[model samples]
Target: GKAVFDATRPDEVRQFFDGLEPFDHLVLAASGGKGLGPFATLDLADIGSGVDEKIRPQLSCLQAALPTLNRSGSVTFISAVSAQLAAPGVAGIGAINGMLLTVAPILAVELKPLRVNVVAPGVIDTPWWDF
Candidate 1:
């Protein structure tokens, strides 16, 4: 079932998935954050926003779907290649994406049998860059 819901709102995410039948895989592609700029001048709040906007929503959606998620299935997280690149002015975003990368391997072990993977794509000319 495809429906529009706010992933950031835990309750909404829970409610939406609660109405769905058991599924095979979950792909977390939600994106939001203001983590662009030099580390020294970056707004600390942007880092927090990265956690709030990216990390929290993905984790919350996964948590809410646990009951319906098949153990044999997989969860794929969408992150940015900035996490692995050594480019300047990406520390904030990189750190944020890196956090997900760090947790994925551990979760792969903990989740057991269930596959947990992250895909870090480089810059894409999407409307998101229009800002």
Candidate 2:
């Protein structure tokens, strides 16, 4: 079964996870690329929005899920290949994605016995891009 909640809202994340029984796995697909343009003109607020909209939500979900997450289960975070590329017009996006890529391994070790992994996949046209 699946339950939907707004991960961006810490209150929602806490409530959702607090109500869960033991779960096998979690796949965090939270994503937002608010600033995807040349660094020179990109609004700084967009960068902050990326952290608020994407990074914070995902991190909050995981933190809230910790108690309910099974030790033997895994957590997969979906980042983007922009983090691994030097493509023009992606500085902000890359920085945000890179944060997740950077933390996955550390979390794996920190959350030992419970797997933590990240996938930085190439662009996939999904409804999230409809914005």
Candidate 3:
């Protein structure tokens, strides 16, 4: 059976995490980050779309679960190199990446003693394309 995952639906998203145990680390990566890198750069619009619908929920859920995480655990978000590179149709991605970059620092500062880092990957071939 094929199950459709909708990030926009909070309940469905939450259900996905229902019985999952707390993790020492959380990684946020998307297929779009890899495919779009070579052709177009990231931009504000990309960021907005990337973060709002995709990244935010994961981040929010993790944050909500922080109390259960190891105090010294790390949280890592995979950003894109496009944050540094500029190209067409990338404004949204770039902005999102930039936000991720900023998020790490903010979390590190606010969650002092907790390590937070954003890995801005260049490109990677993943199963995301199959979707």
Off by over 4 Å in 1: none
Per-residue CA lDDT of model 3 for 1-131, tens digit only, reads 24455545667656655645665765655324322432344333544566666567657655555765565787777777767777665555566667777777888898867788888877667665464
lDDT of 2 at 111: 96
Off by over 4 Å in 3: 1-8, 12-23, 30-48, 87-89, 129-131
1-131 per-residue lDDT for model 1 (tens digits) = 46998888988998988987888899998878579899889998888988988988998988888889899999999889999999999999998889889888998999878899999999888987876
Residues 1-108 of candidate 2 have per-residue lDDT tens digits of 677888889998999999999998999999775878899998878878888888888888999999999999999988888888988998888888888999999999
True-structure Cα RMSD, model 1: 1.0
How high is the CA lDDT of each candidate model?
Answer: 0.89, 0.89, 0.62
The TM-scores of all predictions, comma-separated, are 0.95, 0.95, 0.68
Q: How many clashing residue pairs are found in candidate 1?
A: 0
Clashing pairs in 1: none
